[model samples]
Target: MAAIIGHILPLALGVALSSVPIVVMVLILLSPRGRWSSLTYLIGAVIGLLGLTTLFSAIATLLPPAPPEAKSPLIGTIEMLIGVGLLVLAAIRWRRGRRHEHNPAAGTPKWMSKVSSLGPIPSLGLGFILMLRPKNLLFTLAAGVAIGATGATFAEAVVGIAVFVVLGISTIAAPIIFAVADPARMRRPLEGTREWIERNSSTVTTVVLLVLGTVVVGSGLAHY
Candidate 1:
């Protein structure tokens, strides 16, 4: 389980470092309907991560058993594909970020502005969608495949998966924790962060995708 956690941590942290989702969740927490929306959004995000893990893990069982050498190549191939996709995504975002770096009219996603008006259920749904953004989905799917490659016992597997889900969602859930603990202190710092991310989300996304994609590619190639 520790090995699984160590192996998957970078991908999970890349997911946790996503700016748009964190920004959206922060906006929800600053809304008039802040408390409920924030909580539901966090809940929905957690559910999404766990749900994807479960789906991939189950799908993994459908494959016929193979020797360790044979199995690593197949799983590694999937990871490599995911890495290449992310690298391409990173390049696109990097160029886009550069293109818009000086455009005062450049705008963020439409949904970002809509978070404050959302009711609890819609907030939950939005939470789920935000967490499943393409980069995050691909990273989580890669982690899921890695988990499936483990030969841990069923009990150990469950524990490892739980660790992944918790760590993966930590940054997304950050505001919720401090909201319940100390909203006053958190608000100022978070608000500053929100504005910064709003302006630089594309760059943030690009950097994360580049680093995570490189690591995932290295991990995949190491399998051979």
Candidate 2:
């Protein structure tokens, strides 16, 4: 269980470090309908992450089983593919970041302009959609694969998936949780955080993806 958790930690962090979700979360927290909307959004995101990761884990479990020390070619192949995909995404992020840095007009998504007006349902739907986006999906898949490949008992799988979901949603949940506790005090800091993340998100995600991609690739190679 510990070994499985270790393998999936980077993948979980990859999902947690998603900047857009965090940015949207901050925006939702600053809205008039902040409380309910933010809570629902967080809930929606949790469901999406939990469902997708569990689905992929189940899929991985369908693969042929191997002995404790034996190589799992299927799992290795899947991990390698996921690793390469992440590296490619890192390159794309790096390029996009350079462009955004030079273009002063580069800003938040158009939909975000009206985020303040969104109600709980829309916010909830939006949160789910965000997790379905390519980068987040890939990270979730990687974590799922890691969990499923372990062939742990049902209880261990539950615990593993739960830990992954918690870690994956930590960043998005933290701001909302804090704001709920003390909206007045957290407002200014949340605004500052939103702006900083807007400016530096690409760089942060790119670096994280690079490091995680390498680690995943190394793990994949070891399976052979």
Candidate 3:
């Protein structure tokens, strides 16, 4: 379980560093119906990550068992593919960030304009949809594969998944936590934080993807 946790930590980091979700979360928190919407959105996001990761882990458990030190061609191939995909995504993000560096109109997603008006159910739905975004999906998939590869007992697997889910959602959860803890004091800082993250999201994402892609690629190669 410890090994599995270590392996998935970087993947979780990839998910946690995703700025869009954090930004959307901030918007939800800053809304007129902030409290309930933020909570439900978080709940939806949790359900999405938990369900998908569990599904992937179960599917991976169906693969033929292998010794810890032995090569696994199938898993290796999957990791390689995922890593390559991340690298490609990183490249795209880097280029897009560069291209739009001076364009104030470029970065925000269209749906975000509607975030302020979202009710609890819509916010919840939005949260679930956020997990399906390309980067988040890939990271969750990688973490699932890592957990499944460990061949841990059911209890251990649960623990591992729990850890992954917590870390994966930490960023999105943090602002909600702080805001709820002290809405009066937190609103200003949270707003500033949101703007900063929105401005630099692409850069942060590019660097994270590049590093994690290289790490996963290395792990895959080690199987041989």
Candidate 4:
């Protein structure tokens, strides 16, 4: 039992941390203006997230089991790569934002006007697509493989994965729910928060990416 518990802890931590991007995405989603319908948006977001979780879990199951020797280093490398990529992306975004600030119209592309028309289904789909990013997939796969290798029964790992995935999804969905349900009431605050985030998004994203990448890489290296 002690051994089982020990194995589960690290996997859980990794899974929890992997959800950070989702949380950040959710915050951005809620920042925009709309006629908020919390219930609809929440339900939609949950459904979308669950679908993604299910898809990822299925993919994890289908993967050929990793050799024990390969697990740690591979996972670590993946973490490091993800972290570095995020930082780089963040830097690019920051630079772009700076350029846009100098030319206000630069940030407000016409296509963004079409985003509001996307409705709940599209919004939910967008959320799912966000998770499918290469960085997220690599991290999630590494996490699943690491957990699976620890000798936990498949059933136990599934349960744990499900729990973690739900938590991650919920972190993002909460804001979507709020934004959808009361756009008018939320408009001012959401806009304020959105503006702040937008203003600092590149820096914030870079920092978070670096931190998460460092943790993942460090965890991997420690095993070596």
As a TM-score, model 2 comes out at 0.97
The count of residue-pair clashes in candidate 1 stands at 0
TM-score for all models, in order of appearance: 0.92, 0.97, 0.96, 0.64
Q: Which ranges of candidate 1 are over 4 A from the true structure?
A: 64-71
Off by over 4 Å in 3: none
TM-score of candidate 4 on Cα atoms, chains taken together: 0.64
- Candidate 4: residue 131 Cα off by (Å): 2.2
Question: What is the lDDT, from 0 to 100, of the residue 202 in candidate 3?
Answer: 88
**Candidate 1 versus the native: TM-score?**
0.92
**Superior by lDDT: candidate 3 or candidate 4:** 3
lDDT (tens digit, per residue) of candidate 3 on 8-60: 99999999998888889999899999989999999999999999899988888
- Choose 3 or 4, whichever is better by TM-score: 3
Instruction: Output the lDDT of residue 94, model 3.
Output: 94
Candidate 4 lDDT over residue span 112-141, tens digit each: 445555555555555555566554554455
TM-score, predicted candidate 3 vs. hidden true structure: 0.96
Sliding window of 10 residues with minimal summed lDDT for model 3: 62-71
Highest TM-score scorer: 2
Tell how far residue 6 is off in model 4, in angstroms: 10
